[model samples]
Target: MSAAAPTSGPATGLLAVGAYAPPNVVTNAHYAARLDTSDEWIVSRTGIRERRHAAAGETSSALGAHAVRDLLTRHPDALEGVSAVICATSSPDAMFPSTAALIAGEVGLRGAAAFDVSVACSGFLYALAVGHSLIAAGLAGRVLVVGTEVMSGTVDQEDRNTAILFGDGAGAAVLGPVPAGYGFQSFVLGADSSGGPHLYLRGSALRLPAGTEMGPYLTQNGREVFKFAVRTLGDSAEQAMREAGMSTAQIDWLVPHQANRRIIDAACERFGLPLERAVVNLDRYGNTSAASIPLALDEAVKAGRFKDGDQLLLAGFGGGLSWGAAALRWWGGAG
Candidate 1:
């Protein structure tokens, strides 16, 4: 079914766009106290300075609530009758209840069809697609698609490789019916699960098999993830652009996962998109897992950079060695 999503202005429709990010910034120097790495090293390799993470007693649900709360406040009318909530993440506060359920509860959205999706860094895009499709199928008039992660809790504190790369944050968008020829234009998603082992967790001890203790840290093949992210991310972006029936010349913004500057630069270079146009915030947020895209989306729109009718391409690549991209036609109208 075709998405009736209008694209001229914010209203009576879907993905009116919203997001939230915490204020805490953890510099590499901050990690220096807990690990053996230096700020210079982190900067040289990751193009990062400091990243935002949640405060003590904060959970993924709480940070996500922060973003959702901000979105509701900014566009309080958007959720007046929203039908569903889709949260995307790998670092859910609990494995059983799903982050969506938690968020719905937090918003007092009782009985809303809330659920979670896990596709690593590609999650936001996946959830975005799901939200769009759900509306297109007439299943819901409006959906709040969110990406939240509190990865600090899963980092292997002793392992300097992965510990320095992740932080916590969340972003969201309100999706509803639109006029036409706007909103999500096209999407491309791909994964190489065989490489899942390259970046994976051993799971919490509480959920482990008998005699299998919970691993105190996350693990990864840093070099492999780095290599795959650069190559696959570029390819996936090209595919998404092609699927959207657009050319590299038309992309107004490239909001990619805030994992590394080098990777972001390489993907832009491959697509011939200027580096200045692609949103790069890793230096401040590290890699907020799924939170990266929405975080970047929010920043771009708030900066007055994203204008009406601008073409925005969102892409992401991360653990599970996943990659995704989507094209959005900006509707330059009132919110």
Candidate 2:
């Protein structure tokens, strides 16, 4: 988790979202022959390629700072009224001090409340909700909510199962206040700790004493996690739309977690959303854990896939078997 500043409700929030993928790219072929896999196997299964890895000294917080750097450049004014910073991530440079703290220093934001969120893949959404609520509740003005991950550090490079599906990256969104019906309208968050084992890392200090290999690696059951992702993510999205008094017809975009192309397709099928309405970057970045959504959002905006006041449904599913969804009005943005 990272440390950031505190916020106190702002008017018309979420002024911008920015993303950054490290310059380095590791193609499937780069990992295939060395391991017991092939390029074909990698692409057919995970739709990944050339995922970006951090340079020698790069860390999750560092990459997140890069994203914030670009964000501030494009939206220099978004931080003007910001009151806090919230970073969503499962991995941090160090266990303490919070990655948000380092990122805050990088971005020159020292007055807001800062903290890190550790909700696995749903971390970004968790952070986004917090920022949005703080503004909507008058608790914080504008908030810097970011999701970043350097999964390359956790994936056993030799383990084809996990190594082939992760990449390092960061994405951020600055949330402020907006007129009623102009910002986030409805959101659904749920967790089933029982499914924790299906996707957890053993030997972590957080759950044990005298940590030696705490989270040095990740353990997961792909099949089970995929099933949960498909069903729960779809259900949560639909539930959010309904709660917001909306239907699929009103949704202009579905920015989903870039964990799997298949799971995303399934969710869209269940929601009756056209395939063209989505913005998929899995082929380029793999699963960036919490950073997936922000990365996708940044790309979509850059690619000119949205417009002012467009309806968007953001959803995610991940470890903890947790899932969440939020309905938003993609009001304005140049990038």
TM-score for each predicted model, relative to the true structure: 0.90, 0.92
Model 1: worst 10 consecutive residues (lDDT sum):
1-10
Model 2 TM-score, all chains together: 0.92
User: How many backbone collisions does model 2 have?
Assistant: 33
lDDT by residue (28-50, candidate 1, tens digit) is 88888888889999999999888
User: Per-residue lDDT for 227-330 in model 2, tens only?
Assistant: 88888888888888887787877888999999989988887888788988887999999999999999999998878788888989989988776887888877
Which pairs in model 1 have colliding backbones?
A: 5-178, 6-178, 6-179, 13-176, 13-177, 14-175, 14-176, 15-174, 15-175, 308-332
lDDT of 1 at 182: 62
* lDDT agreement with native, every candidate: 0.78, 0.82
Return the TM-score for candidate 1, rounded to 2 decimals. Answer: 0.90
Which candidate number has the best TM-score?
A: 2
Instruction: List the candidate 1 regions with Cα displacement exceeding 4 Å.
Output: 1-14, 204-214, 333-335
